[model samples]
Target: MANRWLRPEVYPLFAAVGAAIGICGFQLVRNICINPEVRVSKEGRAAGVLENYAEGEKYAEHGLRKYLRNKTPEIMPSINSFFADPNRS
Candidate 1:
């Protein structure tokens, strides 16, 4: 008697189902491992703004020092005014 459990037609179906499950599992693992942290809180936004402001301050200071040393008339007025009163605008 032929073994019904070892049917040749069912092997392809089993292989296809196993392959799909493996693909889904791989995608799930990849998403969990590679996703970045997201910051959505008000405090996180404020911290980002403060960080940007600090970086801008450093850049402005460097530019002003360079301008002073070179005495570039084109950049002098704006940089000098900004340093003289940073809160003006």
Candidate 2:
């Protein structure tokens, strides 16, 4: 029967493939709708990146990245700094 072909062992493989396709689809949609370069260029594609690095930085930043930009790099600041000093002296 057709159900025989749907083994539990293959379920993870199917999920992985589906997730990859979904991520690709999301990026495609985001770039098409939200990326400034896609809309700004007169022709179909930009010949090169923007001449100004700051301008490109301004355009490329997403909401989550922007929000996290100012936060501390450490996940657990106190714990990390404590262990960071390897010297026991």
lDDT of each: 0.65, 0.77
Task: Give per-model TM-scores.
Answer: 0.36, 0.52
After the best TM-score superposition of candidate 2, give how far the Cα of residue 65 lies from its true spot, in angstroms: 1.8
User: Candidate 2 at 89: error in angstroms?
Assistant: 15
| C-alpha lDDT of residue 38 in model 2 | 68
Give the best candidate by lDDT.
2
Best by TM-score: 2
Residue-level lDDT tens digits of model 1 in 18-65:
999999998677445432222356675466534455645554566548
| Candidate 2 lDDT over residue span 4-89, tens digit each | 86999889999999999999999999877766566555563646654556645765886789999999998898788788878743
For candidate 1, what is the TM-score? 0.36
The weakest ten consecutive residues by lDDT in model 1 span 30-39
lDDT of 2 at 29: 92
